[model samples]
Target: MQRRARTYLTGVALAVMLSGGLTACTGSPEDEGGEDTKAGSSGAPDSSAPPGRYRTLPEPCGAVDLSTLKKLLPDAEGAPQGSSTPGKGTASGDEESPYEGQPIATYDTDRRAGCRWKSTNSLATRNLTVDFERVVSYDPAVSDDEQAQLLYDERAGQAEIPTESEPPADEEGGEGGDPADEGGKSGSGGSGEDGGSEAADSGTDGKGGGEGGGDPGGEGEKSDSGGGSDASEEPGGEPSPSSDADLSPRTLDDIGDNAYIDDQLDTGDSGVHRDITLVFRSANVIATVTYDQWLTDKRRTPDSAELQEKARSVAEELAADFDDN
Candidate 1:
């Protein structure tokens, strides 16, 4: 009887210990889950951070359109198999300002085009010398003015001034006839409407004119006059018959110093040998894209098939700035 009682007591002790352990585990489940949830939430990226889109250049770099480029500036006669012009190559490097406050256009020559494949050349011969500027090409079909505007817009931090502003006011008589008016003349004791009319007709009224002092129309006339003067002063006056400067073939010597490698390709017949180089100096940037092909010595039309194919590929790949491979 004594031995059996002792065994029962031991069983009771074991059962109680197991129950206590189970209670402890069950009670801590919510806390453990909450800790895990907190950790996951803390690890996520911050929602308020900026998207970081501004890290790239304001405008794309190393983009080109061969056909359009050809149309814009036809290579000069005997121009090496590329888009550069002969003497123009030195223009970019020359101290003379080719484009006011800007370096002349040139192709790019860099270390990238070593004899890994077929051909090699450098735009440094073109003489482009602007730092930090990048090359951006567009369809030659775009008007020169349009291209200029496009380039202007692509540059980061460049702002366009709103052309509209408050017109200058007349000081003296109402708007039109006041002689004492700061702008010109003012009207005596005329109605506001009459003063406005006079201002419109005479262009500028005398001083002393009420709030509607200076001739509103006068500003327009002055602007027109200024515009006319500018038009007359232009180098040949009356917009140049051709927006394109001489569109002729160019040689390698015509690029600028700031030139950098933009892109390159192997083109032309699989067997024949020919090399074509295209250089671009846009704004402060200079870049070059080269196309190499096997050209035959026979009397033949320029390698259109190879050039066209290569040009098309270049346009597709470099139409937008690409990452360096």
Candidate 2:
């Protein structure tokens, strides 16, 4: 009986050891799963940051002041305000309405908006188009202002304007004659004077005086007249076209963060068309103003100074509106 009881006790101890080993093996997998879950949670990406600086855009048609619009499109002074609907016009056909402006086609109004005003009169035809773009930075590390500056630089590059406001060094050569040409003129003048004096000394004193005086006077007059005419006709004798200067984009100061003007003149069978584009960035918003004038007479072109003045005035008004908003 004692031997049987001892055997039963040994069997019970073996059962308890087996149960502990099974428990430890099963618990290891569960612990490992818990650790993996914690790691996954900690490795998740952060998505709580803000998305962009601007949440909304201003109304397209009402963005610019009415007075400014009238100044830009003089004929639109008495006309009604235009609709902001995309691809739809107040009139039945695509023809622009008398007083109402035209809405530019845009896929997204929240990100961009544009309006156009066109008027035809006996004196001239004028058209004004304005576009607004709201920039949003996706990079978490970049600020709105920095992103805006980058975008402005890109726009300026696209317009082919110099990054800075200064004119190029080559353009300065316009005012002064080339060094080589000046040197050649001086050499030729000296030779002519010397030849005239030599001829005078070889001839009779009285005849020499007359001949020398006549030769020098005639040569001096020809040279002076030729130089003056050439200088006036082609300053520096540079082949640079006047159109290049007119079309080249220029940077503007005292306007927004950065601003530039792009002027283009097109001559067509109908008449001369002048397009003046003024782009300025205020904070995160980019505003573009395009002023167009058409002259029926081919001989006459739109005044650039007047067009620029109108564009700048409109830009200032838009900037002020942005500030007010």
Candidate 3:
């Protein structure tokens, strides 16, 4: 009777285990459609996948303007730099090199490296980053007033003066004589003997020509005719006053490449190195160049204004082109 009870109990346990496996294989109707059930239960409508290119993003490319990005990020050290401004901005380290002039749009340094300035609204990922180096060079066209301003405000000081404000175009007058020359000749030839008498009478009549009052006619001839001749002798002067006072852009070659190299050189025993990285995401790829190496070089030795400008320009140019795709 005890053996029979044990057999019956064992059979019951096996039957119970089989039933559990069958239940596992056939879940509830809601479980058959997981996503649909989730949508219905949550009370949220199902959202289709985003479009191909911009579908993945909240907005299309170029949605964000350059100015907006600039506002979002503070101009602190380690912050991206550009070529547009004159002096350097306050980034990570000390503001040793301050920006001092009007922002430049475009410039070229060496044959291999030329900078182009542009702003974009397109973006693949929600985030974008750009880094550029400033190009530095001395400008021969900068006026003394500009130089003085540069001493105080480096960024404003480095601006490129426009063509209109610059010294007018050097002009050469034609060989043509002055119109007044005809009047003098008429006066001289019209009266010969009367000239001396007229001179004496004119001198007496005149209140003050000083010593020349003795010969009025002769004094008048000397004064008037001499003036004409002097005026004729003068050369054609500079062009009309320009509307633009900004200076022209200069390159490293223009300012002297040595100045650029010296600024990037290190005084300490540490070797020169560049810090750059390549970033990759699902939608885009980017090459990021940093100024950390530049700062390292500067720590060992100070760079010249020209060199600093070049470095700034390079950084800025890269920032401007940070996004190729």
Candidate 4:
């Protein structure tokens, strides 16, 4: 009887082991990680945004064309230190040997890279710095472009550029040189100066300038007449009483998706110098061009028009290059 009991127990144990193996082969709901796993997930809709348009940044040191470099930095063609240039190097480091821009030091080249170039001449000493930043969104809900825009807005705010109050484009009244408005204003008195009024009137008198075809031509000449950007050799070339409105830091419409320019003047041991900076945003990347000139001659101030134009040109070139890529 004892032997029979031992055999029966062994058979029951074998049967139990076989039943467990069959259950394993059938698989559990959780084991498959299919429907069960999916159901267990948070089940929330994905609000994630698309990544930035640019995945990689260009090499900052090599991004600029040689011609542009030469134009901005006169000494780029290889000016020996103190080649009749007024002051010593404005930059902290030794002058760049051949004037190739010096790359800014950054741990992450993928996210940010910069190049700085300095040039000196008897007229004025100039420094140029170009920075490229690739924005990334930490929160899935925010996009790279949106994040970059926010950052740009912040930078612009810190610049202390006067708000759009001085701008005629605002609702209160800076119509941005409407030809009709120009006609009315000049009609009162601006028409007297044939050089200015005639040009403005002709520009406004229906020239295929889009809706405001004549507005640009007319206003540009008005500004020119007032010597706004081109402070020419006119007897009245000194900044007009209204020149503050023209020289004030203002937003630019023709550059990138959005852009602005800041101009500031400071007087110190180095005489009066002008600092012009252009900041623009393209997709998820932000490029900044900072060009400033220092003159030792306090008798003559640096011309805003020349520096502003050069800075804008560099910024525009950088923007165009970004678009191409």
Q: Which stretches of candidate 4 lie over 4 Å from their true place?
A: 1-45, 78-97, 162-245
TM-score of each: 0.25, 0.54, 0.17, 0.58
- In candidate 2, stretches whose alpha carbon ends up further than 4 angstroms from where it belongs are 1-53, 77-100, 164-248
Model 3: how far residue 4 lies from native, Å: 44
lDDT of each: 0.28, 0.56, 0.26, 0.59
Model 2 worst lDDT run, 10 consecutive residues: 219-228
Query: On residues 185-245, what C-alpha lDDT tens digit does candidate 1 reach at each position?
Result: 2222222222233223211111111111122122111000001121122222223133232
C-alpha root-mean-square deviation, candidate 2: 21.7
Error of 4 at 51 (Å): 0.8
lDDT for each residue of candidate 3 in 1-325, tens digit (9 for 90 to 100) = 9999999999999999999978887776548689787777666333322221111221111222333333222132232234333223222453422121112222322101111122112110011222122211134344322332222122111122112222322221234366445433333222222224422322222212111112211211100000011111112111222323211222222221111111112223332222111111112111111121222222332112322232344434433433332
TM-score of model 4 relative to the true fold? 0.58
Task: Please rank every candidate by TM-score, starting with the best.
Answer: 4, 2, 1, 3
Candidate 3 worst ten-residue window by lDDT? 220-229
**For model 1, what is the error of residue 114's alpha carbon versus the real structure, in angstroms, after optimal superposition?**
17
Mind giving the per-residue lDDT tens digits that candidate 2 earns over 206-288? 11111101221121100001011111122111222233233345788867878878766655443455666787888877778
Q: What is the C-alpha RMSD of each candidate to the true structure, in Å?
A: 23.2, 21.7, 32.0, 15.6
